[model samples]
Target: METDAPGEPGPTAERDATIEIDVLVVPDCPNRQLAEERLRQALDETGLRAARLTTRTVTDGTTAARTGFTGSPTILINGRDPFAEPGAVPSLTCRMYRTQDGLDGAPAAARIREALRAAAAAGGGA
Candidate 1:
């Protein structure tokens, strides 16, 4: 197999290029900034700094349902919710993530990184 050169795009790089990241939040969501910051850190750590990132506002239940938004500060990796529990339903509310310590408003950077890597590996951008 061909190997990537230094400073060149590797398999992960190619996969990251095709990944799309979306942060869905409601107006005045308290955790939006934290979620965004963690996401940015994860992208940078994963060498996906150039990945497409979009922040969308979910103002109402209609918009939430239309966009498959489970809650405010929901992070979507290639349109999939890697952190969502089974049977999660769209709603206009703040989302919580279960961390090692306890529940938190925003997912940890490591979690985001894992999600990004998984998405890339799974050919999620398609």
Candidate 2:
């Protein structure tokens, strides 16, 4: 029998090596820096320090729709939007996230970490 130790990566952990992280934002997104910082911290916490990180600029509505960008400062893990709500529509606008305190421009660090872990467990990096 095999067991997964607490806080340790499981079988799919190997996929994390190929994880693709993208931060999408408009030209002048106010939360771009915040989002990037939080994502970096989350990656470190999740032991994905070497994950590939990319930043994309969505300059127009067409680009946003084509790329499935929900809004500026959108973070995609393995090309999936972990925080996306059902029926979310792509837009060229600033995005907001629900946090413990209230609405915020960027997702909390804890939330980003959780999303990364979930993506890793699901072998989404492939």
Candidate 3:
């Protein structure tokens, strides 16, 4: 693992090997759990279990804005918000995820898998 500080060097190599994941959500959204399951399934499908998985609850618009939390189930790899696009609108309401079949609350498991793999290849993001 690498660290910004000159001598910190981050966690041990083994400890740092795990992929960092963030599942950002809001309290009222009904898809939070489904999002978690989907992410886990994606990780399993991609054989990325060594990576770490985490979840965060967005309490207010301020936090959402600060984190650019699109809505419930916004996944972040490392410190970057992979689900967020350059010109996407920021809001507190529930968000819709685009899937092959149609729009849905939960992102497709395969899409999550692809995002995870891309994030890993990108060296865990900024």
TM-score of each: 0.86, 0.84, 0.78
Across residues 1-126, which tens digit of lDDT does each residue of candidate 3 receive?
A: 133354454443333365688888887679888888888888777656667888888888888888878877787877677667577765777878888999888888887877877766666543
Model 2, 67: alpha-carbon shift in Å?
A: 1.5
> In lDDT terms, how accurate is model 2?
0.83
The residue-by-residue lDDT of candidate 2 on 2-106, one tens digit each, is 235777876534565668998999998999999999999998787777678999999988878877899888998888888897888999888999899999998
List runs of model 2 lying over 4 Å from the truth.
1-13
Worst 10 residues of 2 by lDDT: 9-18
Candidate 1 vs candidate 3: which has greater TM-score?
Answer: 1
lDDT of 2 at 78: 86
Q: Give the Cα error of residue 88 in candidate 3, in Å.
A: 2.1
**Worst 10-residue stretch by lDDT in candidate 3?**
7-16
Best by lDDT: 1
| List of clashing residue pairs for candidate 2 | none
Candidate 2 local lDDT, residue 13: 45
